[model samples]
Target: MKKSKWSAYLAVIMASAISCFWAFWGSMENFHEGWHYPTLKENLTVMAIQYLSFMLIFILFSVIAILLPKIGSILYFLIGVAFSYWIFSTRSAITLSVVLSWLPLTLPLLLIALLFWFGEFKNRKLALFIAIGFPLLICCTISIKMGVRVSRRFHDGNYEERIVKGNNDVTLVWASQGPGWPKESIDWAEAQRRCIYLKENGKELADTPQNIWRLPNIKEVTSSLTRNGQNCQGVWNPEAREANYSFPPDKESPLWDIYSPIIYFWTSEEKDKDNAYIVVYHGGVFSKPKKMRGSVGFRAVKSVKNR
Candidate 1:
């Protein structure tokens, strides 16, 4: 009704228009690799979900606040949890609702909810951006956050490479792409390539020069394997696969019982010809000997920063 309310609504309209175009353009660009893939079904699915979530919470709250404003806030809060849970059900969509990511997302919704009751006029534009942009951006921003070299899609479908940095320098590091040999012994060439990759791409202020080396000695390798947190344990799906953040066909989805989450990262340094240092953390901490690579997974690391 008020001028500000109209402005807010206008912003939502614009953001929706822009985001729709953005998603469309993106889908078209990938039409080749996904030539036979579903056309707009998935796109419509995500967009519909996003829009309904925003409208049900913010727009409905505005309508209900005509009488009971506080009750509307409670409803608004529930919308977020519902939205987040829907995301978590699919591992590919988990990033949207995970605790580390959910904080930033929920804050704006909370503010929008409060504003519905507190602001003199409606500003649907802010709500629109929050609704449309938040989900879309969540898929982009984290990949190149801060100053870390956070991507490594080595050997095509072979693996997904990454390095995330922190203020204190090295945080958590591992690789999840290598020969997963269960019946056979681990491959040595793959081990050497992993180390070489790091040496070629390491730095200090910008990348971890020294921190990126392969565990040259067994003592160093074992020490590295047995560390603080345990994300390096468990069996790994050995097929050469790339990291995917979007929906895909049934055959393409990695949700199969056989598909292994990149849980273990092996050091190139070999203790003996048949054995090398491998971080077998699928759950919490890296443990003892894990000779077989079939039931395990591998990824090489390269530190160009303290990341």
Candidate 2:
């Protein structure tokens, strides 16, 4: 009876350790803000959610330890392995994904497996030590590696040169296309406000008159074609072109590649008091109601006086 009780206690301890690890892993960002009480107070909902998740994980592990050690161990182990495999399989960079995603997914499962094994092992104390010690070593190792990689990327000058500006009045931010694209989609009012905010914050366009940094009309948005070359200024409205008709770029619309990330941008042209036009550089143009939202991005343009 004493031996069984010792085994159960050890299992609970191991499960507790795993649950704690999961809690910290999931809530590290929220917990980071807790260093400032005001920030924690401001993020009360997030903090509450983090705390709730931790408690739920703790309860789940504790129950599994007590009632269904063997089955629970296998279940969690398989879950962890499957999750880790899925992450590694889908990732382009396996080593980075293993450090950043796989271990977090599987570490809890490993702990659960060890917890169940504790009851079955003749040397329960040894099993307990191994379960706790091994995961700690892995956690420390990955944490150090991830920190170093992130810090290196931040310090590297390569990250600074993301934006590519054209000879035209318009310029594309580095997130102009492909991955790392901006995910903001705002209404005309909000879009105009954001442009104003950017301008006021000294992100003004060069060689343009003051107050010229505002949202472009449909015509102005289409003016930055690669075909326009050095003369890509103002809006370029196609003659009687269908709203959805997207044509291949000649010199007239060479901007299709330069602004590839521009899936949709809010144009200053208002369809009504509530609806507005959105320009899709490659996909064609469409009208969006004030209420409808999308993953559209915008670029600020300024007109230049001819030399």
Top-scoring candidate (TM-score): 2
Residues 207-251 of candidate 2 have per-residue lDDT tens digits of 433453456666555544333233333344456533322232221
**By TM-score, how accurate is candidate 1?**
0.27
lDDT of 1 by residue, 155-243 (tens): 12323334423221343343433322111234445545434444333321222333354532222222233112221122222242112
TM-score of candidate 2 against the unseen true structure: 0.33
The lDDT per prediction is 0.37, 0.48
Worst 10 residues of 1 by lDDT: 248-257
Per-candidate TM-scores read 0.27, 0.33
Per-residue lDDT of 104 in model 1: 65
